[model samples]
Structure formats: structure tokens, C-alpha cells
Target: ARQLQKILKLDPKTEVFLKRVSLLLTQIAAGDFGGARRRESFEDRPPKVLLKDRPELTK
Candidate 1:
């Protein structure tokens, strides 16, 4: 979670991205990504855009 916190510090909007990445990491760490099923779908938006639209994230 430290890495995710660091990424959040770099760009707070990364919360969503970081969450998804973290989830993926956890799944991979637990050896669950090798199946023929999808875990979850990440938003189709960019972090910068999310930050721009939701400045509250920088807080």
C-alpha cells in the first residue's frame, strides 16, 4: 500500500487508478489472474483528466 500512497502523493487523482492497480496487483499476487475470467474493469479515463475535472482529489 506504500507504493499506492506514493503514487497518490504524486497525483491525487490517481486514487481511482491506484485502487484499480492495487486490486490488479492483489489479484496477481494471489495468483488469480491466470483464469479465463475478468476481475474488474478500470475506468476508460485518464488520471490527468480525472484530476482536472475533480480537483478535490489533490487535497
Candidate 2:
């Protein structure tokens, strides 16, 4: 955060906003942050393939 503040020359308001976000992340484990989120991965993932209708490319 400090590095960003220095590099971006952030205004006071922006600095405060970043600090709030950092604090929120630190508190996520304690339920202080809003909805919790985390990454998940499947070990036996299926390989990607081209679909018949190009659904993968569109959506």
C-alpha cells in the first residue's frame, strides 16, 4: 500500500480507500469483510475442447 501511495502519488481520499481495502482483506478470515471468496481447483480436470455450436467462444 505504501509503495502504491508513493508510486501513484495518490490523493488522501484514494489512500484512505486503499487502506480500507487492505484492512478488509486482513479481516476476511474473521468475517469482518463482506462475502468471503476463495479459489478452488479440481485435480482431475477435463481437457478443453471445441464445441459443436461454438458455445465456448460465445459465452
RMSD to true structure for each model, in Å? 13.5, 9.6
**Candidates' C-alpha lDDT:** 0.72, 0.64
Q: Could you estimate the TM-score for every candidate?
A: 0.39, 0.38
Model 1 CA lDDT for position 12: 56
Local accuracy of candidate 1 as per-residue lDDT tens digits, 1-59: 99997755766566777889999999899988855454233333436878899999767
lDDT of 2 by residue, 1-59 (tens): 99986879978899899998888778886775544332223223323444444566535
Best by TM-score: 1
- Candidate 1: which stretches are off by over 4 Å? 1-12, 39-59
- Looking at model 2, residue 59 earns an lDDT score of 56
Q: Which parts of model 2 are misplaced by more than 4 Å? A: 1-7, 34-59
lDDT: worst 10-residue window of model 2: 38-47
Poorest 10 consecutive residues by lDDT, candidate 1: 37-46
